[model samples]
Target: MAVTANKIELMQIADAVAREKSIDRMIVIEAMEDALSRAARSRYGAETNVRAEIDPQTGETRLWRLMEVVETVENDSAEIALVDAQRQNPEAELGDFLSDPLPPVDFGRVAALAAKQTITQKVRDAERENQYEEFKDRQGEIISGLIKRIEYGHVIVDLGRAEAVIRRDQQIPREPLRQGDRVRAYVADVRREPRGPQIFLSRTHPQFVARLFEQEVPEVYDGVIEIKAVARDPGSRAKIGVYSNDSSIDPVGACVGMRGSRVQAVVSEIAGERIDIVPWSEDTATFIVNALAPAEVAKVVLDEEMERVEVVVAEDQLSLAIGRRGQNVRLASQLSGYEIDLMTEEEEAKKRQKEYAERSALFMEVLDVDEMIANLLVAEGFARVEEIAYVDLDEIAMIEGFDDETAQELQARAQEWLENERQALDAKRREMGVEDDLLTIEGLDLKMVVALAEEGVKTVEDLAGCVTDDLTGWTERVEGEKKHYEGMLEKYRVRPETAEAMIAEARARVGWDVEEEPAEA
Candidate 1:
């Protein structure tokens, strides 16, 4: 073995190549040895059976032939006699490992080519390993990186050696990102695809806010305070329910920090998304009330059977507790694990009255189908619709007009009405605003406009001003021309000149314009 100047320079080149390509130097050394060995074999002919070794420290090169011990060898160039193998090492047996000296010839061109190819393969493999290690443990953590560019809606985030992705659904609404601007997000998910390792990041996830709290508040990390539930309308508002093991420590106060420092940090990170940290209570009533905090709850009536809670707030607090389009109460319902029904006292009282009216209407709808049954109900002094709806059919038959067959029919019809009434009452309990009130209208009545307004549909501005989906869906529930309902919405969008004509026509309708009075002599 001899150390050549070329070998010394090749070692230096391997070091430089490893650093440039982010490959390991050991791979370059192994590949160089293989190339030199292959060159020796080609020079001496394929029968030479050559192998190569490099000095670990000095990078000296030597080539030799590896021949196995044989009983009788047909090819003497590649096989060693058993006697020779035993002489080299006494433990060597027939077909044992043995090496013979091979004549070294410089096959400069072939060796250089083989060296280049080996280096390339080794470098690629090493780079792949480096990439796997770099990104393996980064799952579920938040990363802040530069937005390199966007292809489709997926943003490439430059994270030093590699880039991660921020998918379209992961992005917050109305939040714009630009190249070079730093964006931070939670690592929502990851997968390996044909392109490479795919990483998904998010700013809208509820966990993103929860993680921010953990980072900002020491109480959360120490497990003294726990985030029980989180509901987010990302980029707008977030509600987090927090509970504390320590009785004296206020969970809400801990999250809020001194002068709102902790929460403000999270809000700032979310690009001014508001965070409301409410104290978590095991009691469903208390939890619901707290969930809708900042908007006082007058009462919370829990329905254990249906997993629902009717939340009654003050008249003025109604809008605040319900938020814009019931976003507040919706989040509260999610946080408290109950189907929430939000209303002001005025709204609830009106609902009770409406329910009483529906029950009465149900009684008449069924009994009026048969004259004999109607007479029996009337004779029972079930004069009010609710009274007939509530009274027993057996009691009706005992009086007069009802026989066994008639009584059975009346009873069956009354039960069906009662079930329908129950479903209507339940629907009213879950939703608020115009939809809740509009249910009272059986068929489209000209009086619908007035009745709706009286319940909660205050103004045209109110009627057409809600979310387009909620408004359109409400209008379709009317059992009339679909175009007429759509046209009402189209009317709302009309220009002022056209609106004037429509308003004049609407004003003439009895209840359309409350500002104008009835004509009197």
Candidate 2:
């Protein structure tokens, strides 16, 4: 090749650099133009207004001094009078740039070094931008690379186009990753920093296991089976919940493959991590039972209000259901979206007995009934005296050993007890200085009014300031004892809808300010 200082040679250099750096050709050309402009400024006095351009097709370099065509030339290097500019171009107007070509200079060592530095910096910036654009969209995807090196416990992988890093916390615990090892990880995040694009990879992410299955199982990749949820104790064990839209396909069996081949592939990739493939169910109880695999469950009791589930297993299966260090139940909880509490069948029986005794005790004390009668009421599923007072007389008479006369007597006693309780609460409400307006609120019964008065919420204004959680009993610690406020709604056992209506009515009445009484004069 002949060495020539020509436009063709300049463009060839640009094309080569662009291909090497994987950057746009025009970007490389623009960098070259900037370098040339700097060199031209050095030669034509530092104060000269210089600009440079390159032909996109021909790669020709043009260096010129730019001066504004102004009426008065204050800065000789930057501005030229209209008369002088008109000599070159008759249509020269004020504020127009008049470009004058300058002769090219021979390359000096110092100038060449400066241009090299400028070009290198520009190329580096463009390379970073290219890397960010390439990897930003790759998040949540599985990426494979060679482990380039380990810097302070972080594994830097050579991803061919750009390098990615897996921090110490992101790697599977105790996973032995050596330099030059082939590693597969999930692209967790991509951040553009001042230095370069930061690509974060993770081997411990739940999605990493999901992606591995996607690669190993054709059913998952083709959307025949959907991976509903995944929970991993990275490098130890993991659970995957899968579902299938096609009735012919078994989601769990498809994920497990024939004789566990599919799951085995994913396990091998994760360094011998065990995987439990479970079929997903729309029913929460069924899903939780499926999540706690390898153990037979006797029963599952769901507390929908608390979003918790109690799983009772045989005594012998208790340890297995809970897993080593509670790992099994924890992962099951995460996968099923419910807090799981594991217990043996014996323990559950004891708990039921304790709850039964407590409910019977509550009824006996509140309704002033004998223990035998309280037990009968508890056995009939009457947990509260309010149910007894409001229930149909025929329903109570239907109970064994209870005739119509007895039912009437029980109903009269219950009603009398409630009335007496209300009268006492009303007296307390008056003594607490509760405003009459609060008592008039439709949902504010005598019991709720008394409870609110005790809490220092005696006025409509005070009631309106309370939040829903405060209005409905909230848990707190008092004097080292865990106590619940048992707010107006909870103490009276009012329905939530009724409580909301009462609060709304109170807020509407709270708009009027309570006027202060004048002192005796």
Candidate 3:
């Protein structure tokens, strides 16, 4: 008994394989052609230029040996003279490929094996290419699949047409997945590799929760409500910030649904992760307060220079505001994109008192005045001695305890104290090996020059290397104490703007090219 080769059966097999593999019909037909061509070449001479084609409509398979029509024949197997080519086709021209039919091949044991391998390889390659094209554009999308198997704690999911993997770390914490269970995850990434396409799925990503809400909430799906931001703690807790373009539509309420139906759906999908739905505000302060929801905020002081916010809560609300191990503040910081420092109302009051005492003490020591006089100066909003010396007499006289004569006397004392300090600083500057170039810098007085020399920064280059904090004495540390050098600029009545300008001038003079080192993390 011998196996009969049927062209119709070959076409039927190609169609079935094409449908099963989810690849193009043309790809399957091409694979069949490659296989038949390889089989024909084995039966005929290996050097023969064999080619195969199949009729997509009729399933008719044809085999041909191709020869080039050349002016003169070189190799008898590949090329034919123009006269011989024209005999077969009268319109034959030079360089034209002419085909002559070859006898259909009868499969031998080795030839059949070779043909099967060729078809399998071609079909596998086509399947891989199709899979890559199908899933590459689906990145960042929510997809559903069945868990095919688990390999070393990694879940391999069978998406209808392809397969995806969810690594152990990508799965939500403590969420157990069983084989053959239905799973939904976000398509984190798709990569094409030598073997095939690799699809990476995740359930722990912040966007995964966002996508789930989009699926469950109609307002989000229609773009009436937008997910502003999301911060997730995996299977523990999460916070979502949402906004609505239409005033009539409440984004948070829509996401929550009637009696929490929509949010419940999302929570169920993510293995019951507790979620906080916060209304997004255009104002950063309000948004931060919302992000720290269920925890009352008494006050918020923003430091735009540092991109940080000091949030003050009631003494009883401190634990709630900070959450367990500071999780509440940490998530709020992530959602709001600002660092937050949590403090109780009592703590803030104490801090204010400390600041007030520091300011009053500075005035007392600098002006050689009594504590009462320093307290009166600070109470009158005189932050620095320069303000008292240079301000209009009328403004100084407006203080409750000061008449015009008293204001004048205070100004005189301030000026005299500054002059004496400058003379002493100048003597110290000369005693130390301070360079004259440091004194030439604009806005840098003798006192600042002496301070720099004392800190071993005698040259303009050394001063340029010092950061603003060091130059201003803010970085100075006392032995066995947490007190910093209450900044030279602050102590000497130099304006912060003036100190910055002086540092810039020194840097320009020295032409120091190195960037200042960043503060330690």
Candidate 4:
């Protein structure tokens, strides 16, 4: 009776552990079997190979020592000679594993403690693995849980099945969240570490606002309206760029809802953060204008090479456009994916006047012309000496008060100046020890060669090692600010395609595989 009861209790313990840890029952049984095997080995002899098994249905325990059938026994503890093995089983062959059954082990206090520890460690490991698997694929999702505790400015959330953390930086600034409060957050990341699975949650994530809109707006959730982009100041303000596939639907109106109910619902969830739903446009300039809502943009000048925009507003609108500490323009930049330079109309006028004067001066110096003729060239938008040297003579002739003979004279002077400049640049390039082969690149000229050598790209192989971004710069978001890294040819306004083709040609000349990649659509 006692032995039968003991076996039933063992099975019951395995079942209880599986349910408590939310693990597979078979896993718990396997862990228990391993624990028993370890305990049996301690008693039998450490060198003896032992295994344990429990019958799932009856909870009957079985322990055995494994021995190999060998032609010549090397160690009698683990091997049996073929003739000796055949005596136990007629079918036994050399190299076959034979089991030697032993009487059940009596659990001594020390052995029992070791067995318990092993079972516990195994169960805990399995539980951690299960937790990691559960949350690994749940990243970028919205989850709600009760705030269980606050540790060193981090919020520990009880997600019912597992614990997740919203680190200090992930929380909205000055947003009051207390213990026992139910909060929703974006699942920023999930990592499996030695301690366990760590699920990172964020309330201040820009996508968190989008997810909230998805919950509040039916049209957005159903895909009739799409959120094109989002930028948040977190707990203070946000902008959402929305688009509608259906022509009849107003995406911004839909997101705003009846009497502002939908937006208010989202606002309440995110600690009453103000949201501006701007209609998205395929035209970047139109989109940027829309993103800077309530602040009228009198003019927008886009620099496609740098992905930057200059926005000119009225003087009275400047403060509103810039917001407190430049927040409005900053968020607009983030939302539109363009760096914004906001200024008043007066400031823009002053800048234009300064540019006109500079251009006139440049023409006067390079073409050896008087102020009136230089001003005429500047007014005709001839900003560079290269334009005068290379542009069609008809463009200069077409300028008012300029005859074809005068246009021809200007072109001659411009060409002479450019050739002289090119010679000087070439002298500098040679002095810098730049390889002459670098000048052989189809798109690179003497000026570019000098620039490349100045930047330490002195050889054909050096140019071949370059990526397109090295010659035509790139813009990226760093800590929520748009940062522009000037490229080598950025002053020349070199297109990425031009830079890439030059690099590809250089690489091909240097014996690299330069298979042309199809342009992205």
TM-scores of the candidates are 0.53, 0.68, 0.63, 0.75
The true-versus-predicted C-alpha distance at residue 340 of model 2, in Å, is 1.3
TM-score ranking of the models: 4, 2, 3, 1
Please give the TM-score that candidate 1 achieves against the real structure: 0.53
lDDT score for candidate 1 against the true structure? 0.71
Model 2: per-residue Cα lDDT over 1-521, one tens digit each: 44346878888888999999999999998898888888878888787888888887877667899999999889888899999999999999999998889877776888888888988899999999999999999999999999999999999999999999999999988889999899999999999999999999999999999999999989899999999999999888899999998999988888888899888888888989988888999999999999998888999999776567999999999889889978899899999878798888899999989988998998777767789988888889887777888899988899898889888878788888889888888888888898888878886777777778877888888776665666666777799776876655675556555666666776677663223212323
Give the worst 10-residue stretch by lDDT in candidate 4: 512-521
lDDT of 3 by residue, 1-521 (tens): 22236766777898899999888889988988888888888777787789999888777777999999999887888789999989989999999999999877777998889888988899999999999998999998999999999999999999988899999999998898999999999999999998899999999999999999989998899999999999988998899999999999988889989999999999999899999999999999999999998999999998665567999999889899888877888889989888798999889999878877998998888777789878887877777778988999998788787799888888898898878877888788888989888888887778777766766888887767666666555533478554767564555556555666776777777775444543433
Per-residue lDDT of model 1, residues 135-232, tens digit only: 66777688889999988987889977667888888888888888889999898776665455667788888888998899999999899999999999
Deviation of model 4 at 45, angstroms? 3.2
- Report RMSD (Å) for each prediction in the order shown: 17.7, 10.2, 10.9, 7.3
For model 2, state the Cα shift of residue 460 in Å: 21
- Candidate 3 at residue 172, lDDT? 90
Candidate 2 is scored at a TM of: 0.68
Would you list the C-alpha lDDT of every candidate in the order shown?
Answer: 0.71, 0.86, 0.86, 0.91
Q: By the lDDT metric, which is better: model 2 or model 4?
A: 4
Residue 98 miss distance in model 2 (angstroms): 5.4
Top-TM-score candidate index: 4
Model 3, residue 330: displacement in angstroms? Answer: 1.9
- Best lDDT among the predictions, by candidate number: 4
The pairs that clash in candidate 3 are 472-488
